[model samples]
Target: MTDIDPSVYANYYWVSSQFYKFRQEFSDFYKSALLYLAYTSVESLSDSFKLDLAFDLSLSACWEITSTTLESCSHPIIKSLLGTKVEWLYYILQAFNNGDLVRYQELCVYNSALRAQPALVENEKKLLEKINILCLMEIIFRTIPLSIIAERTKLSIEDVEHLLMKSLSVHLIEGIIDQVEGTVHVSWVQPRVLGIPQIKSLRDRLDSWLGKVHTALLSIEAETPDLVAT
Candidate 1:
């Protein structure tokens, strides 16, 4: 990975180190400027695919202030500039860092700013597309035909095969692609954010499992030998 420029990283590091002092040391207007700078830094970090710094910023005082105050201002371009995107970036960084690909996909949508990232520009948004597909695949652990996957992801059959292989190389998912049967046999899916529906699904599975255990206990008790009086 190409290293971030020393000067640029140093500035960001300084900002991070002194984040808590912004309110105490600076005027309201100056604090606003610093918050903007911090937001811009986060976007730049994401563009460079520097996830660590992006998260550091997200957890910084500057990001918290920006998220709370920026939208309330009267500036015309301010809302469009860092308003929705920074908030979204916070979620993106959190989800990505947590390896909650499902949550990342839930938050990841088509955005011009995301497309403008340097890494995305270089790859024609391939990473974002792959991530969206991967999110869907993680939920579809049952065997699914390649044609079905192609339909769900809006990819051609060949593209589906290539995408699955790429995910394998990255260890995003573990499964076998059956070319002859045209099915993907998935045995393992990575853990990710589980929303209400997913949680409900898990509860149902647990309830079923518990029921089976109870029935097994009943059968064992019925087959138990009677004890003689002692």
Candidate 2:
């Protein structure tokens, strides 16, 4: 094998700095792929650079990026890195990957409070917020009252609304926040890959929905046999 470049480590900042300063040049697909890579690199880099690397992805932007690249960006090493990487930044990445509200909340409550490690306390709070915001869109089904969402997500009522508005502004989900009734009326969850279990659940829901439609159609046929036949 050829000798590796020790000079690259000598100029590590010069190399990693491009990921920060030149983000404008990357397409969203590339940006989304890079988020995971950059997140993984945080521990290896110096303290001063961690937050800058972390904030390169906002909550909604994480969803947007993941949507485009989730299927085909196929990084061979990321799967291996994902499991054992339990550092501060990867916690946020793990939550984003799942889009599971319950899991994300559990992570926040466990790590973001007085129990947080001294070095990780500040970053844990930020990671909790990022995961909460990232997973917000996936939890809506029909109309859910905002109060319950706040309770589950461990956010205040106002923060729930703010998070909803942020997702709406990014076009992550198309929904209405009814202040008078205290409900979030969601019509759609943006398209993204579903894990094996989610796919089964979705399949069951679609079957139930189709059964509802079939019963309605049968009622219409009974009422207007001639019209239906024609």
Candidate that would win on TM-score: 2
lDDT tens per residue, model 1, 46-98: 43334333323433322222112222222222223233445565555434333
Each candidate's TM vs. the true structure?
A: 0.44, 0.57
Report the lDDT tens digits of candidate 2 across residue range 1-230. Answer: 36745444435544444654465433452354354453454346554353443433322233433433343213323333333323433444445656666765566566643244443354555555555655665567889999878876778999999888977887777888999999999997678766566678789999999999999999887889777777
Which whole-number lDDT from 0 to 100 does residue 17 have in model 2?
Answer: 44
Q: For candidate 2, what is the lDDT?
A: 0.57
Q: What TM-score, to 2 decimals, does candidate 2 have?
A: 0.57
Cα displacement (Å) at residue 11, model 1 = 12
